[model samples]
Target: MRGTLGIATVVLSSLMVGCGSNAELKTFTITGERIIVKMETQDRSSGVAENSSEDQLVANINAADEQEISVVITRNEGSTEEVTIASGTFTDDKIVLEGSVKQWPTPIDIYVSRGNEEPMKLHTALLDSETNPNFVLLDFESSDSEDRLILSGVSRMLGDDSDKFTISGDLSSIHDQNLSLAVAEVRITSENPKSISGLSVTELLLDDSKFLIEGIAGEPFLVAIGVSTFDYAYWGHVIVIVEPGAQIEISPSATSSSFVPGSFASPLLAKSQIDESLHRKVIESWQNSKKYLAKMDEYARAIEKAAQPITLNSDVLAVWDPYYVFKELQAIEFASLTSIAQSLEDPMASLLAMEIGALNWMEYSRKLENWYTLASVFEEDIVSRRVIPQQEALEKQLDVVTNAKTIVKGHSAPDFTLANLAGDEIALYDVLANNELVLLNFWASWCVPCIDKLPKLRELHSEYRNEGFEIVFVSIDDAYEDWKKGSEKHEVPGVNVGDLHGFLAETPVAYGVQSIPTEFLLNPSGTILDRDVTPEELESLLVDRFGDIPGSE
Candidate 1:
């Protein structure tokens, strides 16, 4: 028997006539064996006081047919709690729940179940205020054979002034038995479970559980399911663009054996289309990449070690310096892997190349071009359509990279005047005129790394003051008082100025200061010599440009 599925969109009118007015009572009637409710709030307030005596919001679900049904509500806070209403006598069929929300944008999940059957889960986000609430209710029924599932729902937003969103779709083609496929049940076993415990699987691309193989026309869906530790520090994942009704199994090697320094390879151990030879090549490529990554990591550790005393103050520099090293090695890895992918007749080559490109892009935005190229190749050779929705996303990333490149080496530094603690205005060009070198240090008191680097900056100022070298501290603190207190407490030398606007400040925005503790070294002519260099790197550059100060080394 074929199943029928229908969806209805409905909007509920607002109970409040005007802003800050009393809310009128609202009621909803639900009639179905299985129900799913989704609610969204536009501008709900979260500061409402919670008083049990006061009436805030009330939701009631009554079983009109006097049938036994169970209701479970799950809250989506950091720690989730499931409240279940068991099926009972006639009076118990009607479930009434009332509560005041202390937090805005709280998502609640409701699961309704019948005798020994799977429960239907409904999702909704609640706002603290009862002024206006948006809700969507989905009702579903299933056949005895479980071959088909029928769905219908009403979406509604209360209040005439409410913003509405209308969504329409047909599930008629999806209900066809020929289009339905059993999902590939993936089982993973770690080679060394003791080393990496607490494993869980997360779907990287697809958000829905019901995998639609047919009746949906587009690129073949490339589902990337990641098997990682609970903390997600380690990596174990599989990528597959499977055919309809395909099943596969994967067993990941231990983290020590499988982890490439800068990449996550697919665990395509067993699949319908993947033969033993292709699978072996994929594993060999992954293992070979680890060797190169180890070399890169070794070089990085050496550089990190050479820049001694790896304290929190210099951690950013230590971390960033190695990335430059990794990028260089990654280029070589990309070339080698791309060659292997091109030589191989199987689809594994494209998959390997995609993984290489993805890892490169994560480290450097400039690699977006390379990733786009690989994605295009994957689309042409493997899927023949866009397997991932990254074309538009890559375009946006390219824009960000272009914007950030504005402040790179050889670019003229953007000038701005900000007020010092004495309320005196200091301009960037003016400082550059007076000193042979100026380091613009963007910092904040709340930033731990920024605070940690203060003493070292002070030391650098003392060591180079005589050589016409100066450090300018640009505080992005929201309040002048906090900036002043931090400045005076740390005794930060040189010209100390506060933007007060912090990230939104024009100077930092122009400089592309996305994160704190960003430092830029400028020559006397205001040309950006280098950016985000560690104190050790800055000192090395300074010493290389000018002889050591009169101090005996």
Candidate 2:
């Protein structure tokens, strides 16, 4: 509800659209939590109405803090008198502007004119004789706020010739009225170059060959491959090349007169070679889904309009995969950036660039079975006479990579360092710190079932901890604060540890933990006893398997 916020009054009225050619200003009031907002208007029926007569609402960030946020609303993009209580926030202090902005049908964006506050921020940790540097994911935490925000940035030297860098982001509250207004964003987030390190930008354009090369071969520029449009189904190609200068030549290969001429068929990919293909498919998906992406944004807006009232709850949330979006978007950006480095002029520069790209791409190569490629199995020497000998390393890692079961119960747990809410250092070793009967519970906050078993777990903890029992609760949610809040909300009475990782977490692999609420019971001797056990059934089993001494809870 963007038209206003925090007015201690209430009123409602019916307004209809199409009855008039332009939107009319209707006044209303709302009351709550020591805040005041007056009146504004929108199309009666639709949430995101773009009419000339309607009031154009704008909100500026007045205050951000632990308690609450305050924003002043002005009616009409130009007029400052109209006020609307766009939305309300009683507890969490998050606010969104409701109602409609006057410049609806026209593009409402402030990006081409970027303000200082919103551009990407950067912090560097290295300096040397090196002429080039690469970007990587920078991590930071806020335990006081009980959260972690992984700030993503690029690592590359800027060129004066590079007067303008292309990136993506929307008005912070484009989705406030309804996530559906994703249509409202001036720049879509996918366009941003994340963690740019060494890229050899070649122009990406459509071409004639089945393999699209916008420019000459070896020209390495970032390319986003995927279906073009829904109705005009046909294959498309782009040209690419790599060179050693601030700018390079670029041209599109060609376009198909028919529907999608290129068959972006990921399904035909052999199961064994899925890793590489899946990575590519996800990239193509972003390109292909541009329309749906906008539709999804519209969907959010539609719901807010009451045109489609959706039940906002836990069940409805599974579709909003921030983690999936974060990784896939980053991967798409990474692959494009990686392609640039691979197209460089210097052999070593090109080699190092390609290797880095390969590392990132390969990280996601095998997670899906449909995207594998034969290029990864190459025996060619990368640089300096050293063969890219990863077969042995791959073998060692693959030895443990079993089916989904190993994601749950593997032979041995891999060790990695992560932080707890208090900034205390935590790891598998820390969780298993010199304790007998270590109880490891892998679950998440989104998982309703996991919460259901908490009481039984508490009972087991109470009964066995006095007898040297211990419990380590590991949550694999991508959002750090969400995990903390969820744990607190559930009152999880145990040693809690999480990487703030989304699904496909590295920790899960190390412990071979596949399923949520999967309980691994280890004996006093640090030997695995049962990989599959329930909280209700665990207490008795522990008592029976390992004789309990008196005074046990």
TM-score of each: 0.31, 0.37
Q: Poorest 10 consecutive residues of model 1 by lDDT?
A: 198-207
Which regions of candidate 1 fall more than 4 Å away from where they truly are?
A: 1-218, 221-225, 231-246, 254-411, 414-518, 523-525, 529-553
The model with the greatest TM-score is 2
TM-score attained by model 2:
0.37
Report residue 504 deviation for candidate 2 (angstroms): 4.4
Cα distance off (Å), candidate 2, residue 242: 21
lDDT of 2: 0.38
Best by lDDT: 1
Against the hidden true structure, what lDDT does model 1 obtain? 0.46
lDDT of 2 at 458: 74
Q: Clash pairs of candidate 1?
A: 10-155, 10-156, 11-156, 11-157, 12-157, 12-158, 13-158, 13-159, 14-158, 14-159
